[model samples]
Target chain A: MWEYLNHKNGNVLAVKNLRGKNKEEFNYSQLNKKITKASKGFFNLGLRRGEVVALISENSPRWLIADQAIMRIGAINAVRGCNSPAIEIEYIIQHSKSVGLIIESRSVWEKLSIKNQIVENLKFLIVLEDESFGDFLGWNTFLEIGNKNTSEQYEELIDKCSADDVATILYTSGTTGKPKGVPLSHANLLHQITNLACIADPKPGTSVLSVLPIWHSYERSAEYFFFSCGCSQFYTIPKFLKDDIKQIRPTVMATVPRLWEAIYDGFFGALKKMPKFKRNLIRLLIRNSSTYKKNLRKIRNIDLYETSFISKLISLFLVIKSLPLHYLASLLLWPNILKQLCGKNLKFPINGGGALPEHVDLFFESLGVNVLVGYGLTETSPVLTCRRTWCNVRGSSGQPLPFTEVKIIDENNSILKYREIGRIFVRGPQVFEGYLDNTQASLEVLSIEGWFDTGDLGFLIPNGSLVITGRAKDTIVLSSGENIEPNPLEIEILSSNFISQVQLLGQDQKNLSALIVPNMELIENKFAEKNLLEMNQDFEIKKYFKSANKLFIKK
Target chain B: MKLKNTLSQQINYLLKNRSGSRLEEQIIDLIFVEPFSLENNLLTQTLKQKRKEIEKKYDCEIKEMYKKQIKGEIII
Candidate 1:
């Protein structure tokens, strides 16, 4: 990491952090110097190699610097989400045996301090962007201490570090039980960076907008890979996501499914507010573009849509007959419109963190935005497979990355053939070493041969693309012995504009049921427009669901 | 809009169009609440629903609603 930073020329900007309406930029050399000084400071504080240092902070340029600093000194950096509860943070510190902590603010420190004491291994605390409160050391003061140590000392420490050494321990969000520490070695992370370099092929000076939580493995590894490629990254909050996208016009961005859904919702929401004529025109344009792409897919032999034989025959006839209209709509009208909406230079946006609804995938692609949906867990350096720019297939998680081996296995531990849905197990150099000091938990998922059971159910297509079905634990089993994967069903249900969130439930029951959260604003407006606002809410909801049921049955 | 009424109406609407006997028997009852969140402990940080916890919390209400439905009473 340091070598790449040092070799970069022309004072290239590495990271930019949005501050109010302004932005702060850090060049490659400046950030490299900061990492070195921070590393020296850690050494000056008598912090030794293999010691765990806790980093509790929001996503920022300094967060990456501190993470790299820890790696430089061969110490393990235990990163926890800033929004995590105080108890969970304390548990991670104690569990990982973290001797030092690098926090973002004094308020976060006070929150963690409220709990009863148990972190005996905690020797020092360094607060960034805040004044020293109590025994906490401020960021500048800590850096000043490192100024006393020579540059030679920092170089010596870096030389002693090895690729196999534990670099960071990222704690999972603990959906089921206690959050377990996933310790990723330097080699594990390096493999991802090298593999990502070839896969993403991000050119130097390419702009990447970082929005996901940096503490998470998915974002962390991607950030490292982007930085190694010499791409400049801009950090923005959710409130400014729209503004940032327009102004920065990033070439690449990473996001989650919820954000994609929100963007889709927001776009249509604005469209609904437009004048009747303009709205109808936009809708017509979208329909034309969607049809053009669908026809193009059929011509290209990538047709995944379901249609009757007669319908397909008619569509083919219509497509061949109206080639000029398709060309004009797809080439002339849609590209410029979508380019204006998502940024002029936007290549492809990567979606991870959760399953993206297939409708959302089609909606964006129809507008000429390439959406790359990926799949991985925190235990597997976060990304095992992702859709490439060239070979993107909608409704699939794309192909396994280079050097990563993915297989589907049944309950009896038998490997399944292609297109067979089973538990996904992965074996790769990018896989984490083990959970921090939790041998039993590690042994449960990881085999002696290094295959880690992802607990996610998926199948590999004959073309090597992966399609995730649902989680093994989240599957619903009916009393009639029928097992149902709810994710696909829920995703389909969520495609209804009236529905915002849903969870399917019916384990050991006769039939599957769902708990749904309706989009109240849209539903109320729809009811009002029909002069049915005075009716009971129950009746209105019934009508809305009936409409959605028709849609489901039709699909 | 009242959550319970909306939920009950939506549940009935969803079940009404189905033609199977199991479709009627499958969804026993519907209980509505505000959206789930991490603060409410109904959702995890990763945004997954905690099904076991939700079931445990609403066990009594679900059973009582089913009983009311059996008694031909409008529960919502």
Candidate 2:
């Protein structure tokens, strides 16, 4: 990363701030300088190799600077978004044994409210913003400390960082009602950086808009890969996504499925309000193009669940029949739809974090934008498989990477053949060492034979494209791409006196719902003993229906 | 009805305390069903709730809840 940064000496934009009204841009040289000074600043604060610093931040220029600076000084970082649950953040800090904390702001710190309790041996704290942070270092003050000193053997520190050294620790919502820290080494990340270039292959100095939380392994790996290729990255929030897409005219972008869903839903809502004729025309064009694309995918042998020769012949006939209208849609209507959806230059937008909803997938691609879908967990540096241009299957997370091996196994731990649904396991250089300080948890997923169970149920097509079916584990993924580990929520709810047993549901749904068994004894006591009402099972069940509806309406 | 409101009150309190979170983990609605036991496949032999089985069994009820929501039939 340092070498690539040094090589790109020209005045090209490396990183830019796209938040509302905050215009900040840094070229490669300037970014290099900020990171170098920050590294010196970390050094001045007595941070050294193998020391862990916890970064609780969102997407910002300083975050990129701090991330590179921490790595440059031969230290490891444990990163989580500022919006994470306070207990989850505290667990990461406590478990990682982080010495220094680089927080997002004073409010994030205050929200944690657990200053020295979790981090008992804490040394220092740095706030990312420029506020009157009393008794703690502010961003500018920390940089000033760096500016005052640079005589240390920083080059030696860089040389000491080997491929096997742990780079970052990311916490994932484990099935065990706690977040598990996945420690990724430099080699694990580099495998992503080096091999992911084949996915998009963004040109140097081209624009790549980022909207995901920068600390997330998916976003972080994309940032590293794009920045290494010298692509300018602009960070934007979800609220400003549409405006930023038009303004930045990004050629490449990487984001979560939720953002894509938002864009699709936004277009859906807007189309409903459009004039009747215009809406009809747009729908017709989209239908024609989507049909052509779908048949073309089958003809190209990229369509999953359909492999018969008759299907291919039918697809071929349909593709030829629909080609002219499809071409017209692509030429006239699609260009405008693509421009409105992701901008004219969005050639290679990748979506990850969870399965892209089929509607959202076909919706975007119907507009002439090829949205690539990738698959992996944080333990594999977040990307084990990705759909490419040639192998762009509608419902599959393309083949494994160059050195990555993916297979499916049944309940008995036997490998399954193609198209057989089972748990997915991966073996690759990008796979992490293990869970931090939790060998038992690590042993549960990882095998001595070098395969790591992904805990996800999937099957490989004959062409080796991976289709994720469902989860073998307990994590519920909402349609918005948020992963909710139901165990903790169930445990918290079970403590309520009114509930006996609970199972949180909402896989691919908008919000979470639950199957609950009421505590009949407590409920009957509360109503009958209070003389408010006579307890009867049928009447109580009717009231339960009413209460459930009322609760939902309150949402 | 009282049992459901009591649980919602507690959950609402939890959500209130966690205001600035990106996505509030609120249980939009819940269904009152028979207790999950070993006999019902909704609970494992070891007594862990079989979430997938529960979801599959209550699929119609869950969808009805969401449909009720969309139709503005649920009153607060």
Candidate 3:
């Protein structure tokens, strides 16, 4: 987009490279030139306005460059992370009927089942990182095509591109479904650009650490928002997140719930290596501060569940009693801990794309970290409600964005009263027009009046903050007619330190059973003294089953 | 009308190539209805189909689909 090139200070670093081999960084003006050349290159390659381009790549600066290039030429791109199953990428490319493809690398492209067939069908192919393979163009050669031949036609086309024009199609292959293309228009994305300031409100040169996959709507919109505000984004993967946090000293970060759990686990890991007295002292201070913070929140009515008047009165007394401890921890202890953990610059962190585990939310809050959680689906341009920094209510995704109306409705389509849980129906400018090609699916979710059923169950508190309960469609219905939301149960199972992942079964059966992936390292290490690893070598599963049985019963 | 038939033919070809017999995969019978509306109970306010309502409304047509399993015709 021309707007991606239009930041006030073009000299400020825009995209920092942690994934790159050389650790390159690009200023706004440099980013602008790459976009310009790439857009021209794409145009010279016969990619006309409104044509579809399948851009499959993982996290890298080139991904952003390719994306802006496609967009600037008034063409739409169907994006997916190349790490996703090759079949899924094939489905997206074929179903989207793309004219061209901008692939990540040769090694990645080799994974596609029928690469030659796909290449033969497309008008052109450009590999982002590798040498031009056979007839495919490399990133440099493609850019040179535009460099040698000057053209101002792409700029004119950008001016002609309307807000209603479909910008990108992101395939949302949710847990158990076929990939459906969600076509988001320019207007849908622009809504976030203008509106995200209400919660983020970061100054122009804010340092942002990006960890989530940018192909998803949540992270893509965040990238667009941060880019618009001229924030410097340091890109990294989950493996390097802890190191990058210290290295970048980011003032802002966007995250998902699982990453928070990992960080919390790492914190305890570091504490284990400290001197016993100092560790014990730090633990006591953490406990004191947690108690103080929770009590203060109870007084201010920022709790997950209800507390009686007497409890609130007791909380008031506890708040007063803990004042000294709170002050000691806040003034002396936490600043150092925060600096070590979040690099002394974490002003506010954002969480979206999934519900943050309650314990993780409280852990950061206790440390005086402002973790703002937002909620929406991919179809809605992914942000309907977000907790504001100034007026955050713990456990609730805060108020709706400006002009966004969120309604909790029952199966009968009647709006539920406040605090009554139901499916969330949202009507907003950010909501997409329709899914590409699949008219039946589009009609199923989006009403004629523009309301989109989010398929998520949530209730609104009196303060207009939304507390999400669970997924409405993801519920397990038993033969006995009992309904159970499996997400919370799965989360409960996942809380066991030795269990890595769990999925609840028995959708139409009498009882439930779970398929779990054990945290093998922890189990083997802890059970090593018992000769468990040596004994389990023959039938490894039996050992885990026995361990799970022992651990499950104990819990 | 021609474009609709062509689109239908394209879809039928895709289905046939994936799996199944020609008779089973081809577009033998179809109907066009107006876009689902909230005014009728066919569509929910958020536009999801009321399955029971749609079944109730089109009971005869659904029965006809079962009966027509033995035969094929192209109305166009």
Candidate 4:
């Protein structure tokens, strides 16, 4: 919480004013005053210690202020995803039992903008930027009340908060129904941020450009991680990722694999329209560069910063000229590449949120940017495992962070041996307090032994590496009663440039059928390159089916 | 490409004009688009695309393609 304030105080937090292309930067002192006001305001709004206040806003400085202010009041803040549908939004407000809501009125929240009508328990609606809270007391009035409160009163409430006091309730994107609110405490969050900071090791003044919505745990932990390291953080309101990145030239960032995949697909799609020889040459360069880097990683690992003089001289020569060839490739490809996915010179790109394709990780790793693949849920304070540049593992989620323990358990509650696939349970300092208001659900996942059942199936490698196969809930059972891991096959199909999305369908069928989304541009460009323009219709499906027929084993 | 109003429209336009034959007129077994999300699949399934929906949904991929083109790829 203090780190967030520090980030703002330092004049480095770029709140992309979506009203126009113009962005406003905040210094530590200016931001802290607002945070302190926000804290006082929320307290004056009758927010008591242990009460919950729901925050509904897009990415903005006010959002952070409202969030941290609730923490300062010893009240838990429940954050809803900005893109949440109305029904889901209402469900969150009800489930969280939020006494009040802090909202920023815009086209996005206009549908749910009815004050007090949607949330019966809601007492006040504090508008952040505008006086659009019709027939309601505005945030400015609340600010005045907070200003009137003695500093001693504010400090008393803040000092009452212990590490165990719930800080926030983050609702997971429930693919099925009403989202589950994961309740994390101050200690849970700080511990996770500490581990993440250790893993990424961002330098002081490291600039981080965040694309993933701060509503998500991945970005939330990352925001704090950057803060703890004294790094600068910048974000645009709503969505201005592309413009923000070029302007920021961020030293570190975190994103899901889809962003990286889009960059890869866009590059190849454009290349397909190039002259055949030129296209082939670029592909050759990518392959050669990957191979060369793979060898360099091996050489570096062997020497351990003690390279022989001869090898060092060879490296000097390579750096002087030949190595710059790939550097130029990065320079040429990265700008357009960043423009494609709206990212830039991110020093370290951490991947989480879902299972990431190894090929996707390697593609960026090949580009000389260290890509760290991590694993966690909102319940684990969000970060459990993260890879470093030197000891990176492509497919696995890397080793558990310091002070985190992992165990695989069988049906009898027996711990499985290493390299054996079983249910994954994690014990760590940062595990969440529990799901908000869902005592039954919380009991089911969290055991008395402090192991949180991750509901993910995987095994630790013989060398103690975590390999997540698939969600236990997503496992497909065959007629022979054998459970099949669908992720491996689905991941392979997803790796194909032709297939965009894949979901395996078969509860009892002889074999699985997939709902596949084809990359039309890639297929269309391929058709154009192959002189098969006349067959553009159904070309993507045909090519994919043809490729699948050759590779997939027939049942 | 701006001559076309929508991405699916541009795609159909390309298919119709490519090789001087209207491929859209042909009875095709299936139409495929790389589906990144459930929303993408829904949009592709809708035979006619709304300019706003297509533009908002596929903005990232489309802009990425445009950037690649800017870097000198000849789109057939």
Candidate 5:
């Protein structure tokens, strides 16, 4: 990673942080110097090679500097989100045997200071901000200590680091049981940087918006890849995301499905608030553009929708007839609107961490925005398969990355054929070493031959793209012994405009049922328009269910 | 007026139009509440629903809904 930084021009910006009216830019040359100084400072603090260090912070340029510095000294970092529960943070510190900690704020220090006995192995604490509470060392103060060290010492430490050295231990955000630590080596991460560079081909000096939690492997690996390409990254908080997009005009971004959902809602919600005639005009244009793209895909032999031959023929004829109008709409209406919504400079946006609704995918694609949805777990260095720029399918997770092998298997451990939904497993150079200090747990998911069971239920299409159905553990078995995956059902139900979220529940029951959370704003507005002044909760729920059935039964 | 009763009644009404086998005739019982929120301990930090936590928290309401379904009072 540091090799790419060394060759960049001194004037070229590497990272920018927007603070109110002021923007802070750290160029590559300056960042390289700071990283070296920080590494030396850590060395002065008795942080030896092969010891573990913990990082608790939000996304910032300093966060990357601290992480790179730790890696420079051949130390492993155990990163946790700043918002993690106090208990989980303490548990990670003790479990990883982290010798030092680099925290964002004094509040985080307070949270960990209470459990000092459990974290007695922690010898040093470097607080990023200057706010002092206890025995914590300030960030600048710590760096000044390293200034005394000779440059030869820093070079020696970097030379001692090897590609096979364990670099970081990333803890999974446990949704089921206790969080497990996934230890990844430098080679494991470096492989992704090289592979992704070949696949994505991100140009040097491209601007990337850093939004997702940096602690998560999906975002972390992408950050390392972007930095390796010498791209300038801009960090923003959730509240300032919209404003920052306009100002930064980033060429690339990586985010989760929830953030995409919010953008979808915001776009359509704003459309609905427009005047009636204007609203209808934009909606018509959007529908035409969506159809144009779908028909174009079919014409190009990338058929995603299921339809009869006769219907497809008719659709093709219609598409040919409306080619003029489609071109007009695409050229005139969408480009500016998309730019206003998400910056005009966006080359492509990557979505991961969860399944993106197909409708949401279509909505963005219609506006000429390239939204690539990938799938992977933390154990696979986070990205095993991602949609390529040219071969993006609407509903399927894109083809596996080059050199990665993906296969599906049944409960009997036999490989399943294409289109058969089963447990997904992967083997690749990017796979992590194993869970830290948890051999029994690691053995449960990993086979002797090296395939890691992803614990996700999915199947490959005839074209080799994977479609995830749901999680294996989340499956509900009815009393009659029929197994059902709830994710697809829940996603289908959520497509209704009146529904906000849904969870299916029917374990050991006669039939599956769902807990629905209605979009109260839409319901209340509709009721008010109907002059139903005294509407009750029962009436609102019934109205929502009636609308939901129209979408659900069709599926 | 309870949220559970209102949701159960609504679900029962919605399933009345289904035309399927006897097994499919099983009416769905629901207990509506506010959205699952992270602050409420019903959702994880990643925004996934914490199933065990939610099931345990609403144990009483779930039992009442099951009893009402058994009595055939929830079906239209």
Candidate 6:
């Protein structure tokens, strides 16, 4: 880790605490200063080296400050999500047995106060944000304390630290079950960044727009990657994805599938609302495009186009229309219709934290956006497979990062053949050492050979690209032993223009019933075109039911 | 001038001076006359409208949407 930092010395590591339109850039020197001040403040509060200090916060400048400061003091920084439910938050706090808790806001401290009844390991509360914590002191005087620290004291702390010491205890969202505390050492964090750098290859001075609720592993991984690449980071106000994208025009962005879906929905929704001629033209062009691409692929495969004039004409037309269509698509849809996709300065957009819906993957590719899907678990220091510049297999989550070895293991622990579905197991230097102090839980997932069971069912395609099938836990099983994977079905539902979200219920039931949230505008237009009433009142539900009935009957 | 007793009566009272046969047009007129009075306390109180309670109890009113079947529009 020291060697890595030494290599990246004097380079801009990260930008911190940015908001609104006025973008702020923080370099390594600036970050170093903040770390020194924070460490001095921690020392003043009687925090020693190797002590565990839990830093609970949403993404803020202070969170970064405390993160680097803990490293300076050789103390492990336990970063708990600010909005985690009391039980989950308490689990992390108690497991780490932190000497002090550095909270970002009063709201987080209040939530912790209730959980204190069950877990009493946290001794001191240091409020990073200017908020009143009940029975705890506020840190409104950070300026005075930070300013009092000398430069010599700051340098001394940095000189005394080692790379083998624990850096942070990040709690996974645990979509499967109980959230586990992943203790990442400085070496672990550095290795993950290095592995990410090998694939992402983000350039220095690249502006990154981050709004992934920074408490999550995806955002943290992205931040580390950005820092490693010497990029400037700019964050936005929560729920301001569209405006922020346009404002920052970030060279890179990291977001989830839902964000991509929202962007698609926003664009497509506006397209649906356009006058009949325009909509029909777009549909016709898009349909023709698929046929055109298929013929082009066939021509390329057979070499029939090598000498024929007709084939040369066909190739000329493809070249003429393809880039023009992309440009026109951006022009027509991106301005008002696709505002969220207008992070025009973006060179590489990393989609992770959840399954990147295949429809979304196709949509952006069609529009000429370089949307790359990556896969990982929090226990694997997050990024396992990622896309690269030279090559990409459209649907697969790219190749494994450098030396990360990925395999599919069957129920009996036998390795599966290519494209045969099974559990994904990853072994790498980037994998977390163990679940913080939970040996039983650690051993359940992590093998002695360093292979960690990702619990995600996926298969490797012939090209060595990984395609995630579904979560082993999220699979629904019926009483008669019919097992249904919901992820593919959810993806299908999400792709439908009328549908936003769908959850299938069929366990122990005769048939599946889906709970769906329909896009009101699409449904309303369909009703209007049918000379029927809108889907506003309860009585209007019958019209939709009839529509569905007709649709399925035709099928 | 007396308060309308029936929903149709009140709806007509609201729509009497409005143009167009559609409910959307009538609602537009009603809204323009009131100018989102429910958004303001003094205006709603002055109009003697218990907007929150009315909206809470009535789904259509809350959503400001009503679907009435219209024939002869579908080309098929």
What TM-score against the true fold does each predicted structure earn? 0.75, 0.89, 0.76, 0.69, 0.76, 0.68
Winner on TM-score between 4 and 6 is 4
For residues A1-555, what per-residue lDDT tens digits would candidate 2 score against the true structure?
655676664577898988923367899988888988999899878888999999998888889899999988779999988777777787788888898988878887887767768546777789886564765688888899888755547667877889898989888754342678899998999999999987989888999998888777888998999998899999899888889999999998887777887787677678878999999988887888788888888778788886699988988898898899888888887788777877899889888878887877887777777889999888999899999987899899988889999989998979999889999999999998789988998999899988999999989998778999999988888766678776766666665556788887777677777777987776665565443333334446346536644654564
Where does candidate 3 clash, by residue pair? Answer: none
DockQ of 4: 0.07
Which candidate, 4 or 5, has the higher lDDT? 5
Q: What fraction of the correct interface contacts does each predicted structure contain?
A: 0.16, 0.54, 0.00, 0.12, 0.26, 0.00
lDDT of 5 by residue, A1-555 (tens): 575567665556888877422255788888888898888888888887899999988777778889999999999999987776676687788888999988888787676545657546677888775554576788778888879856566678778999999989998754222468999999889888888864466777899988877888888999999888888888887688888888888888988776776677678778868999999998887787788778777765555544567777877886887677768877888778877777888886887777677778888888888788787778888898887778887777788987899999999989998789899999998987679999998999899888998888888876678888766677664533333555545554565555577677765455667677777766555555543323355567656556646645564
Look at candidate 5 and give me any clashing residue pairs: none
Q: Report the Cα lDDT for candidate 2.
A: 0.81
Residue A163: error of model 1 in Å?
A: 0.9
Best by lDDT: 2
DockQ of each model against the real complex? 0.09, 0.39, 0.01, 0.07, 0.12, 0.02
Worst 10 residues of 3 chain A by lDDT: A532-541
Best by DockQ: 2
- For model 2, report DockQ: 0.39
Q: For each candidate, how many residue pairs have backbone atoms clashing (under 3 Å)?
A: 1, 0, 0, 9, 0, 0
Per-residue lDDT of candidate 1, residues A1-555 (tens digit) = 665666864387899998422245788888888887887888888777899998999887777777888888899999975666676777787888888988888777777753336435567888877878777898789889878856565577777889999989988755222578999998989888888764577788899988878887888888988888889999998778888888889888888776776677677777878899989987876766667666665554444434566766777876675566656766777676655566767785888877676667778877778888787878889889998777776778888888999989998989998778899999998898788788998998899898998887888777688888766677564433233455545555565566677766765344456666777766665565554433366566657556646755665
* CAPRI class of candidate 1: incorrect
Query: Between which residue pairs do clashes occur in model 4?
Result: A9-A27, A9-A28, A10-A28, A11-A26, A11-A27, A517-B35, A518-B33, A518-B34, A519-B34
Kindly report the interface RMSD of candidate 3, rounded to 1 decimal: 25.2
Tens digit per residue, CA lDDT, model 6, A1-555: 323443575465467556632234556766666666777877766676778887777776667767777777777877766665555666666667788877777676566445555335555567776654564556546534656746565566667777677777887654222467898777777777777776677777778888876666668877977876777787775577688788778878887766776676576676778899999977765544444443443344322112366865776577556656645655675444333566667778887765565566666655556677788866776788976654555567878987789999899999999878999999887788898878999999888898998877888866577887656665443322233454444454344445544444433222333434455555555554653433343335445445654764564
lDDT string for model 3 (B1-76, tens) is: 4323322333333333331122222333333333345887666788654534544565565446534532222111
Off by over 4 Å in 4: A1-23, A106-110, A113-120, A135-145, A237-239, A294-344, A475-555, B1-76
Kindly report which residue stretches of model 5 are placed more than 4 angstroms away from their true locations once superposed: A19-23, A150-154, A175-177, A305-312, A475-555, B3-76
**Which predicted model would earn the best TM-score?**
2
